[model samples]
Each structure stands twice: as C-alpha cells, then as structure tokens.
Target: MSRALFFRLSAPLAALGRSVLGLLAAIGRVTLYAFEALSHVFRPPFYPREFAAALLNVGWLSLPVVGLTALFTGGALALQIYAGGERFSAEAVVPQIVAIGIVRELGPVLVGLMIAARVTSSIAAEIATMRVTEQIDALVTLSTHPMKYLTAPRLLAGLLVVPALVAVGDVIGIYGGFLVSTGSLGFAPGSYIQNTWDFLTRADMISSLAKGAAFGFIATLMGCYHGMNSGRGAQGVGRATKASVEAAAVLILAANFLLTNIFFAA
Candidate 1:
C-alpha cells in the first residue's frame, strides 16, 4: 500500500517537474528570438507604415485608460497619505508626498501594469490568430521577414510610446493629487503647488520615463514571442494570450523593483 501511494505521488510529481522544465525552455527560446528581432531592427527594408500604425495603436489608443488610472491612483494616494500622516501630526506633508509618490513610483508602475494588461493581450491575440490562420506562413513564403515586418514595428512602437504614455500619466497623476489635496484635504492651493514643485526633481521624471520604456519593451516582447511560438488552433491562441499577460505583468513588477533600487538606492 505504501509503495502504491509513493508511486502515485511520484508519477504526478514527475509530470509537474517536466512541465516546469518545458516552460523554462520555452522562455529561453523566446528570449533568444527577441534578441534576434532586435538585431534586425535597423536592417534594410524598414516598415515605416507598420511602425506608424503600431505607434497609433499602442500609444494613442492607450491614453484614456492610462489617464484614468493615474488620476484615480493619485487621488486615492493623497487621501491615504493624509489619513496616515494625520496620525503622526504630519498632515502638512500631503503635497510633497503626493508629488513624490505619483511622479516617482505610482505613475510609472500603474502605467506599466495597464499596458501589460491591454497591449500585451492585444498583441498576443492578434498574432496568435494570424498564426492560426496561417498568415504568418504566408508572409514567409512571400519573401517577407515577419520579424522585421511584424515584431520590429510593435517593439519599436512599445519602446517609443510607453515613455510618452508615462509622461502623460505623470501629469494626470500630479493633477489628481493636487485636486484631492486642495479640495478635500483643505490644504492651501498655492502652498500645495509650491510644495509639489519644490519636492519633485528632474531625476524623478527621467526615472519614470526610463521605467516606462523598460516595461513597454517587456510587455510587447512577451506578447510577440508567445504569439509567434503558440501551438495549434483556438486553444493555442487562448494559452498564448493568457501567458503573455501573466509574463508581462510579472516582469513589469520585477523590473520596477530593480529599476527603483538602481535609481534610489544608496
């Protein structure tokens, strides 16, 4: 009976271990493919039109959600900071806290996560669907490098657009914080403005933008890689979409920690 039980457990354990190994192997291959795609980014026959469309799709279309999220986050952060700071008789620090939190951390991280949810899933679904339809194969047969045509444009778009989105998010977030601080918190408007400006630095803005770019790259890269390498049929597309979002979201958070350490660590 003990032998049978041991065998039953070991059988599933072995299968689980093999599945884990397969996932790691797939990730390694995808990383290599991403590097190869980057190498071809500047090669001849650049796809300007595709890149332009991608910029519009990834950047312009993403603004509303990014803006709304930043706004809500900033407002909520101000309220929380006020409540917490009041306990320590430091309620006056709301402006400075709002500015620092929105510009330095909240803005970039939220935008990254949002894009991971929105853009990564979109790219993965689109590409996976194309793969299912054999459109990718057709592109190859037509002597078109899908890497250059499809992946490069999306990659470049993500790199370029994420920073812009981050910038916009920062502005919206600061404004949101400002509104809550001045209106609900009964802080003097002029003093709040002064405190925010005095507290935030150019380094904070640059760091935020840098984080945006990194997150964007990670999000799009995961989507494109998973989509391109997805399995056969509808199940494959669904799996690719799910995996892309998960990978993008996890990587964004990890990158945030690493980047924050690099930027602010003594």
Candidate 2:
C-alpha cells in the first residue's frame, strides 16, 4: 500500500516536471519567433489598416478605464501623502509628492496593467480564435506574410498607443491628486498648482515616457507571443488568454522596477 502510494505521487511529480520543461521550451521557441517578426518589422508589405485598427482598439478604447484608475490612485495617494506629511508638518508637499508619484510610477504601471488585462487578453483570444478557425492557415496560403499581416500591426500599435495612454494617465492622475488635495486635504488650489509645477522637471516627464514605451513593448509582445502559439482547441484559447495577461502583468512590474533603478540610480 505504501509503495503504491509513493508511485502514484512520484508519477504526478515526474509529469509535472516534464510539463514545466515543455513550457520553458515553448517560451524559448516563441521568443525566437517574436524576434524574427520584430526583425521583419522594417521590411515592406506593412499592414497600415491592421495597425490603425489595433491602435484604435488598444489606445482609444482603453481611455476610460485608464482615466478612472488614475483618478482614484492619485486621490488616494494625495490623502496618504497628507496623512504622512502631517507627521513632519510638511503638508505643503502634497502637490509635489502627488505629481512625482503619478508621473514617475503610477501612470506607467497602472496603464500597463490595464492594457495587460484588457488588450492582452483580447489579442490572445482573437488570435487564438482565428487560429482555431483556420484563418491563419488561409493567410499563409494567400502568399501573405503572417508576421507582417498579423503580428507587426498589433506590435507597432501597442508601441505607439501605450505611450499616449500613459501620458493621458499621468495627466488624469495629477488632476485626481489635485482634487483630493484641494478638496479633502484643505490645500489651496492655487498653491497646489504652484507646487506641482515647481516640483516637476523635464527629466521626470522624460523618464515617465521612457517607462511607458518599455511597458508597452512588454504588454504587446506577451500578448502576441501567447496568441500566436495558442493550441488547437477552445481550452487552448482560454489558456492562452490567461497566460498572456499574467505574463504581461508580471513583465510590466519587473520592467518597471528595472527601468526605475536604471533611471534613478545614484
């Protein structure tokens, strides 16, 4: 009985190990394919229509959620800053803190997460469905480059639109922080604006935009990778969607920390 139980447990454990190895190999293969697609980006036969549609879907449709998230985040941050600042009687620093926090960290990170949740899953699902339905095979048969037709557009669109979304998120977040500071925290509106302008420099804005671009690349790349490599059935499509979003979110966070360290290192 004891031997039988050990075999049963070890069998599943060995299977799990094999599954992990397979997953790593899959990731490696997908990475190479994505790199190839990227190298082909500068080549001809670009899909302007597909790129435009992706841009609209990834950027325009994402505005409302990004705006609301920024607003609440900024507002909460302002309140927290005020509470903490009261310890040192530095309540006057609310606007500056809010501005820096929003522009430097919250904006890019939040927008990235939003896109990962919205755009990554959408792209993965759409592409997986297309694959399951034989549309990708048809494209191949039509003498079209699948990399150019299917991947490049979405990739480029993400690169372009995510930065725009991040900028908008920064502005909305700052405004949110402003609202909470002036309204609930008893800060004078004029003084808050003054502090905000005084504290924010060009370098801060540049760093924010840089972070936005990096996050954008990670989000879209993960989406396209999982989508293009999705399996044969409905279950595969579902798995791809889940995997893409999770990977995008994790990569965004990791990239944020790395970018921050690089940007602000002493």
lDDT values for all models: 0.91, 0.90
Most TM-score-accurate candidate: 1
lDDT of 1 by residue, 1-266 (tens): 69989989799889999999998997789779889888878787899999999999889999999999999998999999999999999999988888889888899899999999999999999999999999999999999998998899999899989999999999899889889888888989898889999998999989999999999899889889989988899999999999999989999999999999999999
Model 1 stretches with alpha carbons more than 4 Å out: 1-20
TM-score of each: 0.93, 0.90
Encode model 2's per-residue lDDT on 193-220: one tens digit a residue: 8889999999889889988888887788
What clash count goes with each model?
A: 0, 0
Among all candidates shown, the one with the greatest lDDT:
1
Worst 10 residues of 1 by lDDT: 36-45
Q: Candidate 2 versus the native: TM-score?
A: 0.90
Cα-based lDDT at residue 230, candidate 2: 91
What is residue 153's positional error in candidate 1, in angstroms?
A: 0.5
